[model samples]
Target: MENLNRSMKLSLEFGLSGAVLLPVIYEVYANISTSIGLFLVAAFACFAGVKFSALKFREAFVGITCTIAYSGILGWVCYLFIHPRVVDMLLKRSVYFSLDIRQQLYFLLYCFIILACIYLIWLVRFGLHKAMEKFKSNSEKTGSYIENAFDDGKDDENL
Candidate 1:
């Protein structure tokens, strides 16, 4: 139960972050190139969530996946429901885009790409984590040959 709560919190944090950014970026550009901005937000949120969180391997990935999907949904909701004009305009846009099979396929391709990116993020984060642990272990085994001035008056046994 604790793990689930933590996982949900993590998901909400990153999901909201990306969700908040997506529409603003889309609103600002309102063009196809805005896709790049959305992708950047997704990558940033994923990478940050993966690298910074202390959750285990499976949990981290689960949270990140949830975050991605949740954010996409929330961003759409925000973009559409924010204003009546936007709701109508975006509905029209969606209808126009939905008629194209190619665009639908492209959407699937983008989903696959997002998953691939999350996997890669996990790989890099896991590698760095292992490397840091190894470095700390090795460092602990090796110490300075000379004592510092702070230990000058300390002795192992005097009585």
Candidate 2:
């Protein structure tokens, strides 16, 4: 039930998620010098979290979980599909042990997909919440708690 439909909240979530997972991915899977990017993203996440209205901690928790889960899954997939190529690339005794252009692009694509999945998960949650809100609001607006289903214009003097 996060208000992740808002742009600011979504951005904050993305920043925080990226800041957390990018460094981990760099250490675990590939080395891409994410320190500066992590710092910037984390700083923005902090700023946004401070400037915006505070949501329940569950929102942050869920976002972190989503990011971690997505990253973990992506990691395994990459390990299966891309790690072999990277290992082969590195074992070639080239001047640079870094990833090739295609490898770099694949790594970037994986990172982007993880972050995007986090947003997509939260978007689905927000959509469901909005739909329930609309349903509840429609009922509340169209109905009343009063016992009377119909009322005459005249006030009963006999009461």
Candidate 3:
């Protein structure tokens, strides 16, 4: 169906975006400390959420979630395979840090927090949009009432 095709297209786009962006992001963060890099990535996730807001709510939610999953997978691949190979070739040494259990737990906690923040932003945007629509409708009704009142006064003057 058309909707299925559209959803697949969106998913592919998001996946490709993640595949391309995550490595570049890793390169950018390579020189930075890990904590700072994590924060920067979280900020990037928030920006992704904002960008995804352009789509219908359900579509945006699905797309963004897919994007995040793709990014995580790509990031893991880079960390485990590509990065080690590159570092070993260039530096003639292994440059990698295997996170302890606690570190991993912390990382997961941070990821969850980032995801929650992104959804919160989406919810706020949706709420604001609905509120604005309601406000516009109310204003139009008020305008109509004022116009009717003025027309009634005009009829009285004619009499």
Candidate 4:
């Protein structure tokens, strides 16, 4: 049972890591200029992740640093694939008061990425809270069952 719970938690973390990368991937596909913004956001994510992971600063700092490095590598790969098209588009077009197709696409992508990240963070927190409550209840029930079983065994022995 404990192993099952551990595996579930590991799966949840894997899902979250994939979810977090979706925005970064989408932004790369839609617009390369936004890659810089994505990297900065990712850095912030690392810091936020550490803060929210509920670990001591000393332990979390390393995790946050590692997260930043991982994000940077992902950002680099994304840039490699998407930068040329974005650069070409920018070169061919001039700035205007109205948003162009590329600009609009970038805007929409940015919004979606932000929303997805926020939602994932919220979901993770909610899941953790519920898991803690369930663990507490299960622990109490187990403790009571053990106590009752021991008492019953002692009564039988006396009789």
Candidate 5:
């Protein structure tokens, strides 16, 4: 039950983050390519997922997946409905392009790569944290040994 609740919370966090950020980012960079804008949206979604989940890798992954799914749905809706109207209003002209299968594939590929990179970064950070812990422990041991040696030398001199 607790796990279910946690998952739901994470999913909502991801979905909302993706949904809200996508439009804002597109509005800000109106002239940018769709792919670049989506990439930025994905990056922010990932960041928000990780941040809001208390930096838990598994939870962040769940969040990211939810974010992508929600964003895709919202994007499709916008493309089908909101986009044409906005374009018509702004340009007073209609533009049409045939669907390019390659572009769709490339977009998916890029999204996969971005997600993979984020996970890799998390792994590296975890590794560095472990390494720092080991180094700190070794340094403490060395410090204690040096202090013990100094104490022994003082004892010998007093004797």
Candidate 6:
């Protein structure tokens, strides 16, 4: 029952996002390339996230598959509505193409660095959880031993 509710909520959220993106995606994709390469890269990012979230193989694959389908469908819709004229104008006016390639590459490198920082945060969270688990296990063992020792001492006193 809890699983059903969670699934329903996720469905609603995704549906709402899709509906909202349908209209705004054109604006987002205007500067971004419409190439298959970009789409695949986005899909891969989603897949990596899904894999990280889902520990089991089946669950991970299911998430990746769903994400790929959603990404493609959403991207297609965004592409269809994108304002190409505005994008073309921006591209013509921008110094990106005229600027040093090294600078552009450095900018992309910084973007990846930011993403790596976010990944590090997740790693820290995972480490904290493992530490907590280890602490809890050790405490439980200590508790059991103390209880047994007390029981033995009580028996000796009573004797």
> How does each model score on TM-score?
0.56, 0.38, 0.69, 0.38, 0.59, 0.42
- The local distance difference test score of model 5 is 0.58
What tens-digit string does per-residue lDDT give for candidate 6 at 90-142?
Answer: 67887222225674454334334432332344345456667898999999999
Best candidate, lDDT-wise? 3
Q: Please provide, for model 1 over 107-148, each residue's C-alpha lDDT reduced to its tens digit, 9 standing for 90 to 100.
A: 445544664476577767787888999998877655443334
Which is the leading candidate under TM-score? Answer: 3
Error of 3 at 130 (Å): 1.8
Let me know the TM-score candidate 2 reaches against the reference structure.
0.38
Query: Which whole-number lDDT from 0 to 100 does residue 25 have in model 3?
Result: 46
Clashing pairs for model 6 are none
| Candidate with the larger TM-score of 1 and 3 | 3
> Alpha-carbon error at 82 in model 6, in Å?
2.5
Q: Candidate 2 or 5, higher TM-score?
A: 5
Error of 5 at 131 (Å): 2.2
> Is candidate 1 or 3 superior in lDDT?
3
Tens digits of per-residue lDDT for model 3, 86-123: 55564665454445678666665665577556667767
Residue-level lDDT tens digits of model 5 in 50-116: 4434445565566556656776576565556555555565466433332367755655566556644
Ordering by lDDT: 3, 1, 5, 4, 2, 6
- lDDT for 53 in candidate 3 is 60
Candidate 2 — which residues are off by over 4 angstroms?
1-17, 31-99, 142-147, 150-159
